[model samples]
Target: MDKCFYRRGKVSLSGTIVAVGIFMLIAVRGMGQTGNNSVYRLTIAEAIEFSKSQNKWVQTANMEVNAADEDRKDVIRAKLPIVNVNGSYQRFSGLTLFTDGLSHATTGERKPTPNSAALGIDALFNIYGGGRQHALEEEQHLRVNLARLNAQDQSGNIALQTATQYLNLVKLNDLEKFLADQLNRARFRLNNINALYRNQKVTRSDVLRAEVNLSNVELSLEQNENDIAIANQHLDVLLNVPDSVIIIPADSAGMTKPEVSSLLQLTQSAEVSSYTVQKAATSVDVQTAKLRSIRSANLPNVSFYAAYGLNYPNYLFFPPVNQAYSVGFVGLKAQYGISSLYHNKSKIAAGKIRVKEAAMQREAYADNVRLDVRSHYVKYVEALRRIEVNEHSVEQAEVNYRIINNKYLNQLALLTDLLDADNLYQESRFNLIKAQTDALSIYYHIRYASGNL
Candidate 1:
């Protein structure tokens, strides 16, 4: 009876182990599938938001702005009182005695301790810098503004890029669906031909032809799937997501067309609102401030300084012995670099030239912005027209395919004709998607050029 009980216990334990193993296997498989099929659904706006928050380029630009702020703070700190402290220690082996000056008699040697130490603190405040300090402060302020404008420009560029990628993904999704339908149709045609062959109503050659067509369609479907993968990977990079994650557009209809003003109005707005133009204008101001700072170099610098320190073995007494005492002094100081009077002319001239160069570059950028706005506007209009034409083409292709399919079924049309009509239908649908996506992309491009994005 004990043996019997042992056998039963063993059996039960084995069964439990097997059950647990099965459960673990099932759990792991479920987890793997979930990981493989992770999907993130995002709209265009959400995608742009994600890019702004997560994109490396945008983050770097923000860091630049922070660095510029710190630099500005440094410049301001330079104008405040500066304080420093220092200490020193020294060791001597012996002391030397010197003769008295009036009597010309040698004095006995007085040797002090071998160790000595001293500590001191000093402070200085700029009383004047010939206006150079103010110019430096202004220049640093402009640098901060320039960094901010640069960040704005980077954000706009990132937004436009994200929008474009999002739209491209939408287009790829539409193409995927279309290709799937085409694949299904091809398979159905092959099955129909096989049935006809079994009934001896169609030749074997016809079956072979249908098989070939199906194979071609299958290849095209596979290629379309690869394209989808590539598009998803690009979106992942933009949104700062893992490459394995698939991004799906929640709204496949694409972005709405923004109401744009006239080209002249857009150009005018761009001149004022464009981050590039603003940065360039600030650059000119910065250069002008720099020139003022350079000119200030020729003037005198005035400052007030004070120092307090303790010294060992004061030298006021002859044959001095070791003693400690505090000494202090305060005074106003003025200094000028005489060479600046003769050498600063060339530097000043160069600074002026740089200011002029900056102004010229700003003007050139404005001209380019106007050209860019007009070009994008024209592309947007053309895309709109294409979308209209393709919409009608899709309708016509659908009608033509239906007629061809019916005739083929009635044994009055060839498979080639039916296939051709189907291909045309798919192409028209693809064209429509492309046109819509292009229109939206071009619209964002226009906004980007105008720095409104």
Candidate 2:
């Protein structure tokens, strides 16, 4: 009866422990879900969109474009006709306006206190210029375009960086899993060696060696786990998420070798609209406009103006009695400055030099863009080949590991041989992962270089 009671008590304790564990697990899961609710889940496309819309640098570039647009419109409107309304009212103790033989004057004007108010609109429109207005407008337009392209370039860079961090995190997770497996295998081997040593079937040295290997594997696993945590932190920083939040990435099993596209086509596209080339093209336009403006310094500008007003010596309330007069005139105004030494010669010479510099910059830009496209294309091709080679290597390493492990278990292989095979397997796995990730990154880069990004 006592034995039965003891068994019952032990079973009851086990059940209670399990119940507590289940409750804790449930609570932890609930907390995780709640935390996840506040975190944003991002897809690749979503990341790109967020960079374009919300990244600080990209948003600043966008605002710059907007400001440039406003400035351009202001410049254009400045060249157009503008109107102003004028109104005034005043009271004076004494006022005078000379007329005829006697000076007509208001003296001691105390009747309802004198007041005057008038309202009129006048406009000034640019009739002719040295194309300075056009040059300024063109400059603003180029600036806006450059700002837009700059934003696009920034978006591409951010997206690439985010993707890189995400892939690194994935690789770290895989490394953690690999380390965990190795640790478990080491532990099992250590237990078996211990049993053999106790039975005098294995040498004491073998048991000691197994224990050392187990310790090493444990340390490695711990380090890998720490690496994974650090990788997660980096990913969080890139996404602007809370560092404590968990990010479960989508499946990464589909990594494959990237294929190379036509280099000529990519280069051609880059020549037209790649970020670097586009910026250079915009600069040329800006500089050209500036040069034209400098040349316009020698030309004259003409404007027209008109104004009308009413004056009275007393306050004019509602439709009170008032003296109203209208005046209009049309005239063309022009001004030119003559300089002897440096005005015309230096400005024109400077503009020519600027034009030459812009041309040289354009040439350099074209060459650099072509080189960039070609280089990235080569990298993409090389990564493709590396991926293929690494994939085969991984397969061979896995087979070698299995064979060596079986041989070691059967006493046909030395422990060192097995360890060597294991090392090869791990190295191959790492190379495969690196090659695949690199290929994907290179593909994205190719797109970016080709202006698709």
Give TM-scores for every candidate, taking all chains together and pairing residue i with residue i. Answer: 0.83, 0.78
The positional error of residue 450 in candidate 2, measured at the CA in angstroms, is 2.1
The best candidate in terms of lDDT: 1
Total backbone collisions, model 2: 4
Q: Give lDDT tens digits, candidate 2, residues 184-302.
A: 77788777767767877667877777788778878888887787678777666554446775555443624433335444566667777678778877888888898888878677877
| lDDT by residue (tens digit), candidate 1, 330-437 | 999999999998899999999999999999999988887777777888787788888879989999999999999888777889878988998999999999999988
TM-score, cand. 1 = 0.83
- In angstroms, the error of model 1 at 279 is 2.5
Top candidate (TM-score): 1
Runs of candidate 2 with Cα error greater than 4 angstroms are: 1-46, 84-121, 242-244, 256-258, 262-264, 312-326, 340-344
Error of 2 at 411 (Å): 3.5
Clashing pairs in 1: none
